[model samples]
Target chain A: MQRPQELRNLFRLPLPRSFQLGSFPLRSHLRWILIRIVIKTFCGLTNTSIQSLERNKVASRFEVFALRLPPRIQPFDLYEAILKTNFRFKQNDIVIVSSKFVSISEGAVVQIDKIRVSHKAKVTAKKFQMDEKLTELVLREADQVYGGIPGFLLCKKNGMLCPNAGIDKSNIPRGYAVLYPHLPFESADKLRLNFINNNRLKLFVVISDSRLMPGRLGTTGIAIAVSGFKPVIDHRGEQDLFGNILRVTMRAVADGLASVGVALMGEGRESTPVVVVRGFEVNEEDRKMNWQDLAIDPLEDIYIRSFKSK
Target chain B: MQRPQELRNLFRLPLPRSFQLGSFPLRSHLRWILIRIVIKTFCGLTNTSIQSLERNKVASRFEVFALRLPPRIQPFDLYEAILKTNFRFKQNDIVIVSSKFVSISEGAVVQIDKIRVSHKAKVTAKKFQMDEKLTELVLREADQVYGGIPGFLLCKKNGMLCPNAGIDKSNIPRGYAVLYPHLPFESADKLRLNFINNNRLKLFVVISDSRLMPGRLGTTGIAIAVSGFKPVIDHRGEQDLFGNILRVTMRAVADGLASVGVALMGEGRESTPVVVVRGFEVNEEDRKMNWQDLAIDPLEDIYIRSFKSK
Candidate 1:
């Protein structure tokens, strides 16, 4: 559970520093009282609580823009590419980078010819009708290989559920595949730190990847790694509008922002591997998001647990 | 399969109609050839294919803004409230409305005192440690119930997986719960048509609701109903950057845009019920999204299959 003060930070309002009615001059106090009356009348007319007025004031400030980057054939300085775009970074702005972009920058490419298919890989490949070399890579990269479809291996990688252990054969040359970035959290942190130290701007970084949700037809964005802010905002202790204590209502801020980024960075070859989101506020900190904090035990997951009970 | 011509619409370029090289005047021919050379040179320098150049040109045009509307304490005219906001609806603008807003307008609130609990509701409620009346509502609304946790019932409602049959208890007065809107697809389609017939503008409408993904701690937005556009964009026949045909890469454009809308409309007391997305290029039509088109068989779902395989 988050501290009460921290939870209140989500709807922190802008008000006067002091409310000492006696200390204020008569003229100023009369003006303040008039302002409150106006606010109350407005809320009554709109059927809005004062809380919503403050929250919506904050909500309206968010701005998101996708940055077009030069396509990467090999590893290069990511910071330089961003700087070249002439997009000025502001304090607390979030930078969402496609995981594929991070992988390419880290030179995490694996040529198919170099991979030696093992006997296990060959058998699994045959069962799923997949390429033996690619299956070998999936086997090596995945923490646990659950099962597979014809072209995709259902696997768990770095505490996240994904297909083919987050390997990609698209947007790269033939006969080569790009793995998820090496030490993604470290990469995100390093990038965040680079901006802070070199540019003197505190910025958040998120490495995003696209995933197909169960029973859904298309892919949505998920956060692979995050730096400078908590990925999930815990709302367990908060009260709903009905005044019921919310027991399980955390906001997956990172994943939601990732989806926004991915929408702008089209799945096809758009070359927009980066997106900048401004004015959506979250507590900035020198922290890297841990997989353990974001993921739950598979057995306890509702979707998985339902199947187990069946 | 979608027609190949329709698939090509995703990345339709802004090239001139005439491609007959021999029929062009020499000056015009030289200009055309020069343009191609410049494009080729730019592509060569940036490692971007000409396809991406055209695609990014389209990607850069999206703009999203949330509209603050008066809170509805009772059933009211939705279209009237939208017109009250004084937002000029443009062609192809997508209007995302929170499902709660629609539910309220439909008088979908269930007063806890007015509900009668059944024997089965009592037994099921005791098992899940939930309110019997709410349990009865869930049982009544759900198409299929698949077990549950202490406070929530895992159920499929309207071909969509949700907790508690998508019944919401927050943001309303005490002792009352709001059910999912009646005929959500019809509501969305009617809203879309209302804008067209009255305002003389083509508009897309999506009724969005928030849901927690399996193993994820917080909620992301999902589209319950969509009008005026295909909710999913199929990319099956499109070529990847490597020139390999994409087999299964559908883009959940509606859901993605819904998530974007939810981010701006804060879950708590923020009274932003509608969000307008402008300049997002999707073919608009007089069609409502069907569940059969969005959902797949439960047996084929990867997450469930993995658990069953285990």
Candidate 2:
């Protein structure tokens, strides 16, 4: 169990500063009391009254735009391509790039003809009813093969459960496969820095990939790496609507944001490799963070506990 | 294994109608050629060309607005309160209502003082370190209790793996708990019909709730029930970016939409129980669909396969 201080730090909320109410000067106390009364008046109003107070306030909205980039985009040219779409980047805007696009930019594509398949690769390929070269790639890329049905291998790649170790043949040239970016976290950080320097704006960058959930058809977006904000919002000490203190509610903000991006970046020929998510209010701090913040330790994970390792 | 015909039906995509390309009538052949040329031209364009072609095209966007409603609202008045927010409803808009709001409207609040506890409830409560009456309610609401750590219960409610069977204490009046709606699908359907009748418009209705994922901190939205659209988009035979046919990719459209809504609906004090999600293109079919379409069968689920049922 995490200590309260550590939990607060992990969730990136500021620790409350201690202050002595009794030590306040006489004038300060009067000001404080007046402020308290105003706040109390605001809180005492009914729900509708409070809403009508801010009826003109625009609600937070998000626009998911798919940038139609060329199929074989180099990593160095990705930023220019995104800007060419003429979508203006604002402070705190979330820019999501598909990992496949990042891989291609990083020159991570491998032509199948170059891979010399070994005996183990051939045997595993035959057993799994997959192509020999693809099986070899899956084995090399995966930390551990969890065994999968024919045509797919469930493997742990960078602490994530992925099909074929995220070695995808899609969106790449024929006879080649696109590996996940060599360093997704570094990739996101570099992009964030570049965007900040070039546009002089604060923003968040997320490298996203698709993954299937257990028993759900189709894939939802998962955040492979993120920069410019804390990934999780811990609501442990917050009170629920019933005034009951909530103990175990934390929002996976990164994953939820990635899902929003991926829903617009469809898997088909929509050709949207990048999406711009705006209007989400995120902490503006651009501190260094790791994708591990979103990862569940294998031991503590309920799904992993239930998993019978093949 | 599902037959190709049945798979197509389950995914709800239209099967290709058999026609001989060589035997097309003269006018039909001309039309086909024109369409082929247009599509080829669209596909062949570079990023800049495509952007310039549709320079004024707005990207798919969503706005999540919370409707502030008085507590203890009757179910019939919920729709009127939502409309009173003054947000315009357009064709194919998705209106998401928090299930807690739905439950409160349905008069599903249980006063803890009025409940009589059984011996089983009392012992189980002590074992789980929870309130005895709440445990009794959890026991009654749950289909099967899977045991839990202190202060939580792992149970199945409406075939969903929910904590405490979706019984919530938050956001309700004092000394009362809110139960999950008796018939979520019916609730969604009724809302959809009411919206259509009242506004003379087309739209999707989703009743959403928050739930924790197996090793993740915080909660994301899950769709309890949805009407006016297909919950899942199956991409079984669709070709991936690599030109290889995809076998198992089904997009959980409803859940993804729910997550988008829930991300905007903060758990604490953001009393916006209703959200209006605009601008995602959903298949606008008013056919009756069950929430079961989005459920994963336990036997077939990878995560469930590993679960050691207590």
Candidate 3:
């Protein structure tokens, strides 16, 4: 029953100021916008070897870059950087990084050989009349795989959706597999703390990845994990200059910004993995971002939120 | 895996060679950096109705009358006069509008009794655990009523996330309700075509609404529908200045621009519905907008793209 005017009294907290990104020049500043204005990026990778030494070496190599940013800037690790570099970031600073790197660093990547092929993966593969190469492996590693949709396979381990069975091939040298970050939100929290303690500034962090949208021709970044951020920006109760209060106004700021930021960074070759954003006209104060922020409760989500399957 | 490269690509689409906006205080035409910016203000007539309408003729009462012009020696509404009065609009030229008027003209506003509940609504009411008084009526008009995760009841019809069980109580008559434009995209297309054909210019139309996000504070404008514009600018697989090929990069040009454009117009008592955006350097080729462009498919989505609830 409430419209824009009624929204005035509903705030559990203050609204984050809006950003004036258009004020910046489009040429050189575009990347700056992606990095500085960008938020997070996620990725999944397969490995040449799952050896602990290699893993540590890769983490260490990433660490090398992490230590290189201005101490004012968050460290390179998405989690640690956000937590440690909070001060350098502002209320609307963008924390852009890849999820593949995060997953690899957190040891989410698992050995594909160790997974046990399940009877279901075997049977379901037959039922869908599809290949068992990947499904067989999924059956072994998955706690439960649902037979609902395509492009994504549900695993029993966690309520996560990833491509190639959440197994990556990017950073992984040749044959090894990887999983998601072991403690995603924890990682984000750690990074959140890092930024908070390092500097007196309030900041947020996002662990993101480059992903495909089922029916679209392009891929954008999505936050796998986040802290000190609001995933969606609502505008349900507000007015325009025309004396008209708007209805049904909400923006998926995280995803929307992630997509733009990631696009500025390029998909595979560009490794400018860190984006530090500042100067937003709107945003949260001390709020922490979580899965709920990026995801619609289905209550607020309209299209994909509900469905009728045959 | 990718991000946006240089905006030199803004020229990729057929676009004007040059443009500018706003007027400089001293400079006759270069001062504001804000030309054709429509400032809109809203009032609820349900509280005052005919009385308010008596004072509410928009074109006459709400138009910018007393504002001072920097130095442009001209009779005002130059932009509006040309766009609205002359009914001339071009391609690639960006038009910012209020969704409300579009809704009103489209007959989106309706009487509450006109609604009908559904069986799913009953199940949803119980699932959402809502008060019985509201539940009975909610079920009728609700296209689908879903179970709540814990403490919320969700009712959806047409995939729009609305409250008051989707009943609105503002501006319109108290006994009536306003539904979302039956086919917003269609409405946008029709208007877009009129402007394009008449003005013979590359034009982009953005239908805006001011509303709240379920979990956040404050509200901003959102593009409910767009026509003749590239809503999203993707940069996946592009190279950054750092020579790294960005993995997942895409920019929500429309949404970002919308957020910023709405902010530039300033909120409240400023009643200006149409914002004429100029100086933005982009292209305008295909002048038709499809709702699908604004949505992401699950297959390519990172979250549930390949996942089912466990």
Q: Largest DockQ belongs to which candidate?
A: 1
Q: What is the DockQ of each candidate?
A: 0.20, 0.18, 0.08
lDDT of 2 at B71: 52
Local accuracy of candidate 3 as per-residue lDDT tens digits, B113-227: 5555556545655665553334555555556554333223344434433333344434444454444555667766766676656556656667755433322333444566777
Q: TM-score of chain B, per candidate?
A: 0.79, 0.78, 0.56
Give the runs in model 1 whose Cα sits over 4 Å from its true position: A1-59, B1-61
lDDT of each: 0.75, 0.70, 0.44
Preferred candidate (DockQ higher): 1 or 3: 1
Name the lDDT value of residue B6 in candidate 1. Answer: 29
Q: Looking at the true structure's interface, with contacts defined as alpha carbon pairs within 8 Å between chains A and B, what fraction does model 3 recover?
A: 0.11
Could you give candidate 1's per-residue lDDT for residues A157-199 as a string of tens digits? 8887878999988888888899988788998888988898899
Docking class of 1: incorrect
Looking at model 3, give its docking quality level.
Answer: incorrect
Regions of candidate 3 where Cα sits further than 4 Å from its true position = A1-92, A104-120, A126-144, A155-178, A192-201, A209-222, A230-277, A281-310, B1-101, B105-107, B113-174, B190-203, B206-224, B230-310
lDDT string for model 2 (A118-197, tens) is 89888888876899999999999998776666677777777766778899776665788889888898888888888888
> What lDDT tens digits, residue by residue, belong to model 1 across residues B10-84?
335444535433455456444444344433332332212233343443236355667888667699888888877
Q: Is the docking of candidate 2 incorrect, acceptable, medium or high quality?
A: incorrect
Interface CA RMSD, all predictions: 8.2, 8.7, 18.9
Report the lDDT of model 3 for residue A20: 35
Worst 10 residues of 1 chain A by lDDT: A42-51
